[model samples]
Target: MHADQRKKLINELTALIKGGNAHVTLSEALSGIPADMRTTIPDNLPYSIWQLLEHIRIAQKDIVDFSISKDYKTLVWPDDYWPQPTDSVTDEQWADSIEEIERDQQRFFALLSDEGKDLFSPLAWGTGQNIVREAMLIADHNSYHIAEIIVARRLLGIWK
Candidate 1:
């Protein structure tokens, strides 16, 4: 990786992470959770808080894998990657998925540091995309879905 390029990517991801942290702390993302409420889908969707976490985790993991792996095919997930009953997850399970996602982010960043710019040539997502772009997309994607998860958790009365 180009040191300067890598630094730039790190800075971007760091900013995203910091922003997400602030949003989670200050926003109404998970503030809808009402005490004594049980799981109920606002829509007919099968996704729950846990499922969203898994979805985010899997997507991030795939991007991280793609960042370092020679083969992009191996980084993609099949249709069944999302957990069933997505909204019925226990608090502990949701927490576990969140932790895993964070760990995956760290692993991905470390891999980028190890691989440098050489590992960042464009492959699938963009015909000629670099790892920096890939990492930014990954970070941005995670922030987006995590916000949704927080909101969903609040809707399910589990965010508190």
Candidate 2:
């Protein structure tokens, strides 16, 4: 990657990460609502705001791992893994977990810089990919969850 191209990639990734982080932080505040207010659901689904946070963190971790590894074949999904429901968890648990998630996201974004353009290189994911494509996907994934978080907060009456 040339100097200019690398800079562009870094800028794009940084913007995406920063925007997502802000949304996560905003959502975290609302996740601290009283337990009684959390009982309502939009579609009888049990996906609490906390569960969505965990899900997004999992995907963010995947992108960070992919950015650092060289071999495109390195990506692999673990067996017996399932998205955990966090509705039963306490507010304290949600607060603590989201703090850690924010920390990890900051570290991952730090990898986006002039020298970090290698992350944009074509990677083999049982198909093929470059960093730009991966970043875009990750960004979109984050945005999707952001919308969900917003909706969940609204449904729970904690959007304030």
What are the Cα lDDT values of the candidates?
A: 0.61, 0.62
Error of 2 at 44 (Å): 3.9
- For candidate 2, give the lDDT of residue 107: 65
Task: Highest TM-score: give the candidate number.
Answer: 2
Number of clashing residue pairs, candidate 1: 4
Please give the lDDT score at residue 100 for candidate 1: 76
Per-residue lDDT tens digits for candidate 1, residues 72-96, read: 5653245745555533556676567
lDDT (10s digit) by residue, model 2, range 55-113: 67776666666655655234345421125543366667666766766765676666555
Which ranges of candidate 1 are over 4 A from the true structure? 1-8, 17-22, 25-40, 44-46, 71-78, 86-92, 118-120, 123-126, 157-160
Evaluate candidate 2 by giving its C-alpha RMSD to the native, one decimal: 4.1
TM-score between candidate 1 and the true structure: 0.66
What is the Cα-based TM-score of model 2?
Answer: 0.69
